[model samples]
Target: MNDSLDHDITAFLDTWTLDPNQTKSCFLDLKAHLDGLDGVRCEFVSRPGITYSLRAAHANQKKRGLFAMVDVIDDDPADRWLSVCFYNELVDDPKDMGDEVPGGLLGEDAKCFDMYESDDALLAYIKERLGAACHSASCE
Candidate 1:
């Protein structure tokens, strides 16, 4: 990881208040999956807890790039979970993946999912969605 990403990730871990063990492992696993996706870049976002946003680095125009996000929710500490949120206005939910919750939990036009499994199928699903977001022509 680059210095900025490393620093951001470290900061993210430092702020987590849940089961440090599971939180770290899950976050690492999720990061690994995001790293595997083509043109996708992940960054840490500090809020009530640690969260992340994704973008398409290859997109020539910033407005045409992706703005999907992933969040680590440590609400219960013992039963912490991660959420993958999509900008509903810029992306469609053809698969109806994540639960459509209020934007306060994530951001505007968000579709959030608490991904508890890091299996291949789930990762592929996430990649597909993220890919669509990255390749969107009308991201604005």
Candidate 2:
């Protein structure tokens, strides 16, 4: 991440009130995983009162700009949650833990996992999907 992006992300996190369940940690952990990827770049988008999204993509991807989006849903800013989305073709939902959104991802079909509370098991599963998506995107 560049200085500007790092600053922006820090600002977003700073203002976000942590929920009692510690759901914010889930986003932090996922962001750290993305930052560790070999050739990944992430852009942070803030749509205040709607969402604060981290859009991540592999360096080699040509068709789409992003492979996954980690969003902090801000409908209820005081009680925020997460909705991580990925292109359907890039990741497999073997455990059926995500929702099938017909056109949720930039007009393409997407598989999204919603998190309202901190859960190590679910976070681990999502991390696996992120890795899978990064690999698939890199191949493109």
Candidate 3:
């Protein structure tokens, strides 16, 4: 995307809210496209448009966390793109949560904030910033 366009998206997402309802909307949209997909979780998470996450359903795959990876494909005949939100990186195993934190409460290990580009031109920029690994993704 052009510099101006990228700026515009950033400006828009700056105020984006990851409301529960919108998260559900994103998840449903992804489901319609991917088959045999499960454990989908979506959220705006301060990112532009609809954003999402989930956990790998294949107990042994080891794509641990709430979001393991994400994918995006062009939507036919539309000004939009479809996003596949896989794994919710926001889930910390009960044993990892803080000393007194409840199993249901999210700990630092479970929170993730990151974004990707569905547009190739902009994607290159993202990849650059992402470097060798997904950017802004960390939990220790």
Candidate 4:
């Protein structure tokens, strides 16, 4: 992440009211994982009262601007959840944990995993998917 992008993310996170469900921590974990990936860059997009998203892409990716999107779904400001999405082809869902959304990710079919509470098992699965997506994006 660049300095400006980091600042933006920090600002958004700082102002966000933390939920008891630990969604904030989940988002932070995902962001940290992305930050450790080689050649990966991320940008933060905030649509107050709607959503705050972290869109990430690998340097070698060409088919899409982002390989993954981590969104803080703010439908209910008092209780925010998470929606993590990836291009359908970029990650595998062998465990059938994700929901298939038609054209959900930047107009492309996507596999999305929604998290309402902090679940270690689910978080681990999502992290594995993130690794797979980043690797696939890097090869493109």
The C-alpha TM-scores of every prediction are 0.65, 0.98, 0.21, 0.97
Which structure among the candidates has the greatest lDDT? 2
Winning candidate number (TM-score): 2
Error of 3 at 93 (Å): 33
Local accuracy of candidate 3 as per-residue lDDT tens digits, 9-36: 3553343443322333343333332223
lDDT of 3 at 14: 47
Q: What residue runs in model 1 are displaced by over 4 Å at the alpha carbon? A: 11-26, 37-39, 48-61, 64-66, 102-107, 117-120, 137-140
Worst ten-residue run, lDDT, model 2?
16-25
Per-candidate Cα RMSD to the true structure, in Å, reads 4.0, 0.7, 14.7, 0.9
Q: Each candidate's lDDT (Cα)?
A: 0.59, 0.95, 0.30, 0.93
Per residue, candidate 4 scores C-alpha lDDT tens digits across 25-127 of 9999999999998889998999988999999999999878999999999888779999999999999999999999999999999999999999999999999
Per-residue lDDT of 5 in model 3: 39
Candidate number that wins on TM-score, 3 or 4: 4
Q: For candidate 2, write residues 78-129 as lDDT tens digits.
A: 7899999999999999999999999999999999999998999999999999
In model 2, where do residues sit more than 4 Å from their true spots?
none
Candidate 2 Cα deviation (angstroms), residue 21: 2.2
**What local lDDT does model 4 show for residue 2?**
81
